[model samples]
Target: MLSPNSVYTSKKLGHYIVTILTIIAGSTVVATQINLGNRYRGFTITQLISSYNIFCSIILTSQFVCSVLELWSRFRTLNGQLLESLSCVGRPGLSQLLLGWRKRGNGEDLAARLRRLQHVHLVLQRAAELLQAHVSPAVTFHLMYSVVGIIYGSYELLVVSQAQNRAESMIISPSTSYSLCWLVHHLFDLVALTVSCSILEDEEMQASVLLRRAVGIEETVPQVEAFLRQIKRGPAICFTASGLLPIDRRLLVSAVSAATTYLIVLGQFGLR
Candidate 1:
């Protein structure tokens, strides 16, 4: 069983992380909105309104990212507990090599452990369901916008590096502060997404390892094998972005690499 105090503490920690990320996102977004508004002052009111709408939409997206991070943390805690519970079942489902193991009432222990494992499995399934529900609605738009934003950030960074090389220095100004804040926000977003997804993938593998060990036990417990076949029959429980792609460390690396590629293409083409 999971301790209530520990779960609450984990939740609190997640909230703190979410709060900090939100602050970073909100501040950068506000500055961006202000800057754009000034640049388009002569534009029609409808155009200005549309620009602000885009800003608000992205700010909401950052909030969703925070929520997803929290869900990932919670699932990680549940999976860890499940792994520990499986370890308690002991090896080979018996204490000794003696033939009368079942006759000595070890069956009861096996039965109880099997039940406990079932309960943990259900908890894990529910956690996945909850995460999917939250992710499904936004998954389509989320990836597209995130990729574009990160690509743009990478391009800006490249431009700044080249400018510094030519001038031997850079100056601090409002625009520079805005660029720095945007870079920080994007970098923080990347780390949060990568860590959570990687943790989720690790837990998925651990669950399979635990199930494999349970299958090897000599005990004829039907539930144990049934559970294994159910979970591993199709796929291990890992986070997916709207069933389009699985989110993991690989996704993180791929996103960054793709962004870099786009940055190079845009640079060579000279935006001329």
Candidate 2:
């Protein structure tokens, strides 16, 4: 049984983790961009444009992360509440059993509780829908950005590594360093996004398992029957990017595979 306090503590921890990671990523990108700019003389137009581009990208990425984190926190709270409700439904107090006017009265009490939990489940679904609606566009754009960035950045690194001998490549290229940093940053962001969604999906599964157990309790009610039906017939309890791309470990896997394939093709073209 998950306590509300524990859920709140976990949410605070997640906030700290996200904040620290965002700082590190943003700093690394800024540092690399500065290093690259130092190579050019007189703070030229090209350098100005490059700096502006990096700034904008960092800002947008940070905004997307913040949005996702907020939604993730809400989902965690609702998940915890659902679990708590389901657990209580499974176990009733001994006092309630002894003092009830009759078994029928006790059964009615349990049915009412189940009905309330059913309401909670409905609210949870609504929260999920709200989250999806608000973040789907941003998520879709982020996914596309990550795919393109990884493919191009990987290609650039490969070209640099190939063009220079080991010693020269190891010691001489700011561009190589920048590309490597950018790739790491993008990959980290993508992994974080996918992991967050995966965790929420796992929570949904946990709730379903608890609900199934609740079905076997001695005082089964129509609410329980309808609850099971709702679980089956309701919209899939999973996250998606614009209802087009499912955001999960599988998305991460497919993104990496596609990037690798494109990188290989680009390498072949460069060789030719």
Candidate 3:
């Protein structure tokens, strides 16, 4: 469905360019930090994790973006094919006017269209399986790094802010600026990931709705019911992080709540 046409070409090109630029930026930042002895020169554990927080955030964000793109590409194709298949419903008028009514064996034409729909459904199911399998591990890594980054980064920022409040004059260091940017990057990364999974869920819901329509059309075809029944029996394509966390807006809300709670607890205990 997404062939090398203008719409597809332009969209793909833009995403690729952005991804490349992000990769270069992340790599350059890490290299600079190491060369400037910001972390690599007999770094303490805190400094090491601090460095890792940025590096992992970048890596995981890129992986999530790529995975989301791939999944979206497949689902878009599925949606297009689904529309084509739906045309077989002969909802009257448009399809008949375009191709003209078949004067020959009408049953054969209907059967062929039904078969095409079945084939497309099979392809969609296969794609959904592959997408889930490929992205699950990456999602798990993203979630893990996200939790660590949020908690640790928030602690660092809170302590620094408090110190600055007590100081007569605030002096900003390169590391401090980098840390601030790092925290912002984590926020962006989390939002990006949350949106990506939400889109996947939406696509799956679209497919389900299409199948339900097919079930409705079963009144006429009677045969499409078999195919629809098969699909309906299986679980819908649900994206989860390492089979534990469901990727949804609820996950995003809960993660924020949990992070905030922990940060407060850490502050109370005088995390140093």
Per-model TM-score, in order, reads 0.68, 0.73, 0.69
Clashing pairs for model 3 are: none
Higher lDDT: candidate 1 or 3? Answer: 3
- lDDT string for model 1 (154-174, tens) is 666665555544321332223
lDDT (Cα atoms) of all candidates against the true structure: 0.58, 0.63, 0.61
Q: Give the number of colliding residue pairs in candidate 3.
A: 0
Mind giving the per-residue lDDT tens digits that candidate 3 earns over 1-272?
45445347446744774575376446545644653455346545655555666566566666666666566666666655555555566544544444233331234465566566567657766776777787688768877677666666676666666665532232222344555555555656676677677876687567566656655544666555665676678676667887897877777788788779987987787534
TM for candidate 1 is 0.68
Judged by lDDT relative to the true structure, which candidate is superior, 2 or 3?
Answer: 2
Worst 10 residues of 2 by lDDT: 95-104
lDDT of 2 by residue, 1-272 (tens): 23566557556756765675566466655756576557654456755565565565556555555545554555555555444444444346542242221222334355566566667667767777777787678778877787777777787688776755442333323366677777776786677778767866675565555556556653455666776777777775677888787888999999899989987887787644
Which residue pairs overlap in candidate 2's backbone?
A: none
